[model samples]
Target: MHNAKPLPTYLVQRFQGWKATSYAENSAWYRRLASEGQHPRAMIISCCDSRVHVTSIFGADTGEFFIHRNIANLVPPYKPDGQQHGTSAAVEYAVTALKVAHVIVMGHSSCGGVKGCLDMCSGNAPQLEEKSSFVGRWMDILRPGYDRVVERKPDDMARALEKESVLVSLENLMTFPFVRAAVESQDLSIHGLWHDIGSGSLECYDPKANGYVVV
Candidate 1:
């Protein structure tokens, strides 16, 4: 605790600015949200990359989306092993507790996590191959996806694997019993999306086409 310091001057200044402007103008709205609890319509599982702004891309407001950010926006298959599964825990809370109508797995271009996986797979990143690497263990969840896309043309390999991360997550989410039940009953729907940050383009998975179509 001794190592914990006060907020940086820049962050403090930014917070003060927010309090004076955004918070001042929407004090009542903020209070209402605090009292009522959140009732978001969708759950978005996306990469934690600073460049990927899920809320801004969708123009979402406070409490509008139950968001979970991870290395590559992966959802591991249902295991119920009584282990510490942060991503699965968030999924359970969003699906069973919050009853979000839709669950979205969004991947993005030039994802560092995806690139790390590619490097690890190609034997270029030995550090991630070590036993104690937290990121290595987590990125293992995307190994299947990387393997599936490794045989593709070299030029398309990165982009293909990026999209595969989204697809892999959507598939793993279905492994959850509750999620399957909800989807079967039409209570919940799942979506897979790949976003191009530079161009702000989004491509969605189309089962019929067996590929991502720009949206």
Candidate 2:
């Protein structure tokens, strides 16, 4: 309570504007949503980068996507030791409770988290090696990806690692028992995607081709 404060003036103004316009026009829709509750068909696990606008990228409306964002859009391997696992909790709720049909792991170009992982793995970013850094620990989920791409040419390393993040997360998502069960029963499907921020281009991992295909 001591740290709580009133909303900033600009945000308050923006909220007021939305309430007077979008909310006013969609009052019934909003009410219906409240009564019906959210039943999003797909769950999107994406990066925390603000530049990678998840909604606008897919032209999604409110309540259409159950989104869980983390550093580099990484999902840690299933570790159910009763720890406070934010990403895993979101996945569990989406698959088990919401019964989402699809889980998409999305990675974007020029991701700072990916670059940090690259630096950390290369022994260039010493600060991220410390135990106290939450970011460092979180980025550890991408270490396997780094190992896979460590030999790539310097010009292509960043993008390769970025795409690898999606692949790694997709692999790790299966480690969760609920997620695995859902996939096994054909109740859930998982996918991986990489996006070019500047070009607005998308690539989907094709299992048959065993590589990414432009989408």
Candidate 3:
């Protein structure tokens, strides 16, 4: 009974079975896309977590969204170094090359990254300094947000941290020159979205009200 094929093998076989026909339904569009290149309408900044898939959640096709997934859905400050800037590069491509009209920083409830940042900000919490993980360094993007809310309350920790991280990423998004230029020209817009997985509720930041409201 245990001699059965591995799960990945089964999944791959199932995927291969569907590829030609399932994808062929959109083969014509794929051909056009190959010819003209991608010109996505929106760029989505999201977490690398498996549960936070932007494309599937938004029901978008291949060219609908220019995607960037990072440890905490962080948007780092733009730098011209030769080092690998994964999220920054994706943002650059979306803003400069794809000319995407909108960017969404999608944060979810109970995010490990945000939680880590919250813990790091709380002096009484365990120190992450001992860990050599990249997540520790990447989560530094939300330090300012952590500082802004860490003194408030304990029960509000996770949600406050999540919302603060979203705002931090939105600010970081504007740090890129191309994004700033596009936004200034009114060709681009930025949004902060927080999804509560537990309640299946969606909260979007309202610029006018300066807070998140259920959508």
Q: How many Å off is the CA of 200 in candidate 3?
A: 2.6
Expressed as tens digits, the lDDT of each residue in 157-193 for candidate 3 is 8888888888999998888888899999999999999
Model 3 off-target regions past 4 Å? 1-7, 123-127
| lDDT for position 13 in model 1 | 100
Q: Which parts of model 2 have CA positions greater than 4 angstroms off?
A: 152-154
Clashes of each: 0, 0, 0
Candidate 1: Cα lDDT at 36: 96
Candidate 3 CA-lDDT value: 0.84
Per-residue lDDT for 20 in model 1? 100
Ranking by TM-score: 1, 2, 3
Estimate the Cα RMSD of every predicted model relative to the unseen true structure.
1.0, 1.1, 4.1
1-215: candidate 2 lDDT, tens digit per residue: 79999999999999999999999999998998899999999999999999998889999988899999999999999998988999999999999899999999999999999999999999999999999989999999899889889766546899999999999999999989899999999999999999999999999999999889999
Error of 1 at 94 (Å): 0.3
In terms of lDDT, model 1 sits at 0.94
